[model samples]
Target: MIDFRYFLVSIAAIFLALAVGVALGAGPLKGELDQQLRGTISAVSKEKDGLRKQIADLQEGDKYRDSFAADIAPDLVKGRLNGQKVVVVALPDADNGVVKGVEQSLTSAGATVTGTVSMTDKWSDPSQRQFLEELATRLVTGDVRMPDNGSAYDRAGVVLARALVTRDAAAAGRKDSATPTIMGAFGEGDLVNSDSDLPQADLAVVVAPPVQAKAKPTPDSDANQAWVSLARSLDSASRGAVVVGDPSAAGDGGVLASLRADKQARGAVSSVDVADLASGQVATVWALAEQATGGVGQYGAVGTTDGALPKRPTAGS
Candidate 1:
């Protein structure tokens, strides 16, 4: 609808404006613009260097703390769990190093670690539900009673707990007569792996897997809930039980996180979310001792309403 001349004039005006802007950038405004750009770059460089130094200092501080905790760990946990028999239960994907560290810590606390029971991936596999339920039903003996109504894992927890742990101090460190048969069934079924000579323990420590950054399972997912059920059942069946994991395991979708979010589970079992560290290892010992004395707490770097560690017991307590 516009005239041809007007269109041409508008185009020419635009080009002229661009030319003027280019001239100013190349000539009159060039020095000021370059100075401002250099100033911005210099400020950014300074900030980056400052941030790097701060991060380095923080890292060094963390290293020092970890070293100190490791050095003092033995004395901190010494005799805390004396005369207690503890079992280490390694969940699927559990870190071997963490499990070993936990066992060593328990030993340092004067507790005898009966053995380690490592759960297979099939322990929580959906397809194994029927097998687990049937096995648990078959394993229920006069000494071990299955819940009237519960998930397959929940019932399996009862059977497993009865085989591995006992609340009676008189029976501690001695295997039940049916332990061999029960554990053999689970082993043959690919539900768990354990030493052949495992004795019944008075307390239990469940080592969970570290958190995954991607594709993390939901807190209420069946697998996680099944694990929670097992842990709670262990606590109910044993003298005491504590679940330990790395700090990342306290994050969303992590087993420790999921357990903490569960009201009933958190109320029954203790947990430590920094089991990968020396401090958390000491905390695990303290938590177990606390459990022996009828106390329950959640400890470590996250959701620790009970504080970083349980109260240290008095000498000879």
Candidate 2:
């Protein structure tokens, strides 16, 4: 009996030793396993971001230039606006006939031309011309392939939508819909206020340079900070449309930043490079903008909702 008891104690000791060995082996392996899991999660996150960007581009079909473009589509396609002022911007001698032609078509449809301002520098300024050339290159190589000669259509669609919304609102009785007219400046420093009472505007058009087409379109750190400051000074919901002839022109970076930052501001936005944009493309952009605001003509629901402009301003003040 004594011998059996001693043998049983020995067996229990051996089992305890084996248990300790198993725990020691598992500790290092557990850490390695945890590290592997973290790596996998990081990789998956990056892949998801890439996929989402691709999906967004596909969904937008060249309209992803900004967010407001997405919000104001309905009114542009319906031709809900006419008789409102549309502002256009570019160099004085840009030969941007496409931009003017599209605007005219909208006016013919019923929009009022409020103002047109051109930059003094057309081709003589090296910095400005460089900007245009670069912008043209980007248009050709970037996702927004400027239709060799049909760019006016795109320009027309975007502008037309904003005009329609502005005019429709003014006609509907939004007393605040009107704004003081202003021209695009190299750095206009917050030109218009969304809340100001003014000359009874049906719409506001801001013609300017494209600020995001440079080999390094982004401005330096100091410029970037100043641009943000300028954006904060403006009304949060300024409704307007943009027509860009060159993306690399001076002061364009600041403009793009401010407009993009004020994402929810009540407005429509579009751009065209007169130097590179084909006639049809510009027309299409303006037409789309007009249709979103319910201006004159109709565009198929490529980017609009319910095919209706923003509720026309309350009927008659």
Error of 1 at 152 (Å): 1.1
Scored against the true structure, residue 164 in model 2 reaches a CA lDDT of 25
lDDT of 1 by residue, 1-317 (tens): 99999999999999999999999999999999999999999999999999999999999999999999999999998888888999999999999999999999999989999999999889899888999999888988897767878889899989988888888977999877878988999999989998655899989999999977878888777778778888998899888999999987788888898899999899989999999999999999999988888899999978656899989875323
Give lDDT tens digits, candidate 2, residues 1-317: 56998999999999999988778658867788778999999999999999999998887965554345434433442343444444443333334554565555445435555444433432223334344334334323122223245222222222222222333444522332212212111223221213222223343333333444433344433333222222221111223344333333324443433334334321334323332233323344454354344332211222222222222332111
| Cα TM-score of candidate 1 | 0.93
Task: Please list the C-alpha lDDT of all candidates, in the order they appear.
Answer: 0.89, 0.38
User: How high is each candidate's TM-score?
Assistant: 0.93, 0.32
lDDT of 1 at 31: 100
Task: Give each model's clash number.
Answer: 0, 70
Index of the highest-lDDT prediction: 1
Error of 1 at 282 (Å): 0.7
State model 1's lDDT.
Answer: 0.89
